[model samples]
Target: MSATTLTVRQQLVYEKELCERSFKDFIRLAWPHVDTAEYKHNWHVDVLAEHLQACTDGRITRLLINICPGSAKSLIVNVLFPAWLWAIRPKTRVLSASHSFDLATRDSLKTRRLITSEWFQRRWPIGLRNDQDAKTKFENDSFGAREATPLKSITGNRANFVIIDDPHSVDDAKSAAMRATAVETYLTAVPSRLNDPDRDVIICVMQRLHEGDVSGAILGRPDLDYDHLCIPLFADGVDRPPTSIGWIDPREEGENMFPARYTEKVVRGYRASLGPLQFSGQYQQAPAPDADGFFRREWFHRYEPSALPQHVNYYMTSDHAPSGNNDYNVFRIWAVDHNRALWLVDSFRKRCTMDIALGLSRDANAKTVIAPEGAFALIRKYKPRAWFPENDGTWAAIKSMVSAAMIETKTFVTIDPLPTKGSGDKVGKAVGYQAMAAMGQVHLPVGPIGDEALSEYAMFPAGKRDDQVDADSAIARALEDVIPAWLPIIAPKKKRSMFDDDDSRATSDDCWG
Candidate 1:
């Protein structure tokens, strides 16, 4: 028997083993040396049991499950997993790969010790003449050993079952490159060892890290097949009917989680440690803008009587919405003449297709049209090249475009050029976001033509669908680049000379205080 299992009080662990299909016996049978939490999830165990049975019956093999942390992942794969395998196919050769060799050996040794324990041996004893080799050729003629090595170093498995336990660590989850390394090594090196036709039934469990992590690489390639599951709260990733699934509720459905009295406990931690976004991401799982502090309301408001021209070239940008789900791209053409005055002109928007946008542009007779590159492909058959940033994708283009639209309303206040004064980085960001919140107050023209833009500009429903704002952005960007003189500048007032008091000497005989 291994040292760890001897430490466990049988009175505590074995009490309920006879009552139910004791999972403790399963743990004790597979891994007697190590102690980890164990629980039987009826749904998850059933899926695992069926899959494992298929492997032994020569029907199906090779499986993968992706799950989040804190979902009893270790107990499922680490302890009860090996015991279940041992119970099925006799002397089944198994190889397990994890992120590290030490972690691998620790898990292997624990299982090894369990199979060698008195209780486990009583159930399925290891009886072999060549005991010195540590290989107990079981009654079923199947035998397996544990070896923890780098993913690149698996020489020969000659095993039937293989389990990979999170080959990537938390740090690997962060970096796309590191995750790729772990995945590449596993695919190339580890599987070469198996000898049987049913080679190895491999199962991998890990958290969803980046989009390009090991799980992603394995999943993206058509060479391998995987049943994908994504559940943050549950231990298993198998998609179930939503009628009885999703976030867990402690009380009755719709009953208040919070009573009337404000304890100020949860609010205190929210305010103290993190910014608004950190709370949203860590607690609410909502992603926020990566760049919030750099842009400003005052920077947007460069409008002046001189800033306008008499019937030159100008445009009205609006992010319109047909429904609450997505916004419609809308914009109006304009002109500022040499006399420094403005004139609003034609408008453009469509519920469905660029056919409407093309007709609008052609009717307006605009040569240098500025629009999102995504919408560029549609109308280019008629108009000149619709200009967009040289390097940007659809999503980023949408965000910048919306910020540009808010500038046209003249709701923000600024002088000529942008102001950069007495402040460090933190103070500057605080000031910038403050200005942005203030800019939210501006209301676009409320006509039927502008109704879509106003509603979308207000909330931009569903937190996505920014194409409407993209159309508006095209207008704002064109103006900012063409007329640099239109940018606003906030100047500081001169300080008062309070030191020139009667008692305060400030003459030829200056007082050196």
Candidate 2:
């Protein structure tokens, strides 16, 4: 068959290739300085294009994507999308919102120009749309678009698609108040501008940090739930490579994306060097694991408690993670045996009070407790055999009421192995994760482990949050001192006797037999 006689399916595949190739061209040719295809965005943008088409096919309405930054996310949301919108829903009124007016305006200009470009003109005939000084409108479709200002109020009698992209800038990402204001704008203002609820759709593309920004607000809703497309590019689910996972995981000091996401050599050398936040957000596509805290998923070994060696001088340590209607506070009891092999023996994470927490720990035969000062008075009420509170901030002050005699003086909790914030918990979480992976991912203990702790910790790092793991880390740290390394101490059997004889103690000698 001749080229002109190609089937519609063939033509579509060709068009898709064109669109994909065009994206590459747009990045390399149109805007060389702004390297677009290097990071998480290749998958993000690809999925986005597919989803928009899926919308055309009546598949889904809300398309929610959570990714880190360097991924060419904006190109899909801001630059390529408006044109895509026009293609899908001709003359569809499109309203785009970003964190700042500048970003929104710049993106609007980009889309508007692309449509009027020689490339766009090559695809769609000239007579269909009209352009007037940076603003483009398709009179045939009754659709027009311009950059939106900070919404005092959004009035849209003509908007067919409301696309909210990056509602908070990198700066605003650090501020909770700013994030909250953005959320308010989305909830209160954006809807005021919607013209067609039936045909109109809302697509939010953002990197989630604090739960305050417009994207976070939209994400918080259950009824208005949208599709969540997580494009974790760097080594799949790893932050850095040389890691257990993720090719370029920071844990491994990846030089660059060797098998890079978008294009093999799309990212050149590290320009200047990416901030930890930017690296994880943009290229890696991982949300910051711990925004404020120092610890993250990379801190422990994927250990199984049952496999942990059995030896004497084994003491259990407890520093629980809290749980409630909202947060899950975990109470973990880790033990180290005579061989100095640390095992996370039991865990207790629940939405109950101090009484229940201590009872759970004691019943599990937890011998030592190291905790945040917040648990001092409550734990003291239960009288655990030993206690240790984290030695930071006012934890020292709480000693008077906490009975320092009951608690260990030294506290060794490594939030992050390194002391810094702002980066994704790649390094800290990774080290811990490698430690856990090298050991055991989860513990399925054989006897007397708290069921709650077992369930939570076992489901951990993968359980949508990281509470149990933190407790495990504390327990692991406490094990460092308690485990016998210098000299093994064997308790002397007092007043020998017939019962102490190996031949007489049939039950105790059963394992050897």
Candidate 3:
């Protein structure tokens, strides 16, 4: 019966049944008490609710939702979903976590407010156990429990449903250590806490903070089989792939995710307020900008392996952190062709202690230091003419080690000390190579190596690491020094006088030669 035709008691029963059957109905009914402001309903709310209900039905065990901030992700997934879930299955256990314990507790408190409200108890009547109820955790009469904790400190806790909300703070996401810790925690700690390995649910909700954030980790690992729901602030016309439960984002291209609140004007304002990079990550749900950063993506030219010129001379450049630094050790091998173009043949990048990265010796007795196989393999295959290590205090050690390695392998190559500049000129060092790339003279071999090098150049100074690009600069310096011999000089054509006879005119090539 319609609400207008039903009695007061009948209406209450009808509403309770609707709340139980539809998660969206639960959100609409529970929104008022949780927020002082009025609830502005939107279509994305239904999309979120549908996927979440699929989680409840055991159709989706792993779900990742990446949405713009202020879209009520925490409210729907963290606060309201748990309370509503308890109404449906009071025996369920949930462990909600955030980047900070305080943030987790904040959502926990909101969830508690809704469960304890008179409206909730009158319908569902899943009373909270008075003795077990607390700020960070609580238990219900049906043995259902909810706990809150930070992502880093989830030891000795198990749950049927693990909710990770905003595990990386926007401010701290820039730190490599912080991003690594978040990814590590999600990989190592998050999975072990599932009470039921076969049927438990893991729901991660957050904006895209970094390329290596927890969301990135989940999508990168195909073994996880996560159902990802990525809804940026503005739709780009690309239909989101259907979830296991068959829910796809319905917004068309260029439509705002939540048009009820964020209009085109408001989105424009946000783009201006938060610069391109920040807006791209948070609002667009993209860790990198759509366009290029310091280096244009189009400027990177790809070369086929079989098309490489045989007359090219190869050179290798190595860059690493000085003493007491933890920068990555990067080695790049470039081939300079007869036309003065630089082709990136191969590269090796690793982050470790100096001793482990570049071992001190290659002797079989010393297990701590062995031949650098990755670098040595390139040397053996390409037979670079010279190798350039930064001209620092350790250059002599590097030279001696490579020389010994070459002798053992019977490979001939020269080891040279690369010139250096002041510490503040890291970006300046890459300028020469960047200019060459802009002119399409620098070529990168197509594969994982090329993809990685292009990504490093795309992020450049703002990226997490720059050892690869810095090594490119060294290659540029080497090419400048050696290109003159292999490349033919083409001087500009000389101007001719109008009175000169046609037969007696000297050929244009003769004057320049």
Model 3 lDDT tens row, 392-448: 766655666667656656666687666775623777777778788889888889899
Model 3 residue 51 CA deviation in Å = 1.2
> Best-fitting candidate, measured by TM-score?
3
lDDT for each residue of candidate 1 in 1-513, tens digit (9 for 90 to 100): 554565456533443243124443454344323554443333444443444445555554555555434444555575456655664444666666777766666666666566566765555545422443332212223544444444545555446666677777656544546766777777776566565635456666665444445666676674665444333221222233321112222333323223222125754554366443333222222222122212222223233335444335333333334342334545444343443232323345655433233222222654333343323322232222123321224224444433343243222212111112332332232343234335542223335534554333332211223454454444434443456413333479867587656576656577655
Candidate 2: misplaced stretches above 4 Å? 1-50, 54-59, 65-73, 83-91, 114-143, 149-158, 168-193, 206-225, 228-310, 313-325, 353-385, 391-466, 476-488, 491-513
The alpha-carbon root-mean-square deviation between model 3 and the true structure, to one decimal in Å, is 6.5
Number of colliding residue pairs in model 3:
1
- Candidate order by decreasing lDDT: 3, 2, 1
How would you order the candidates by TM-score, starting with the best?
3, 2, 1
Task: State the weakest 10-residue window (summed lDDT) of model 3.
Answer: 365-374
Give lDDT: candidate 3, residue 332: 78
Per-residue alpha-carbon lDDT of candidate 2 for residues 169-265, written as tens digits (9 for 90 to 100): 7677565567667778778777666676665676777775443445556656857746666555444543321211111223233333334543444
RMSD of each: 14.2, 12.3, 6.5
lDDT of 1: 0.44
Off by more than 4 A, model 1: 1-33, 36-54, 58-60, 127-142, 197-199, 229-231, 234-513
| TM, every model | 0.47, 0.54, 0.77
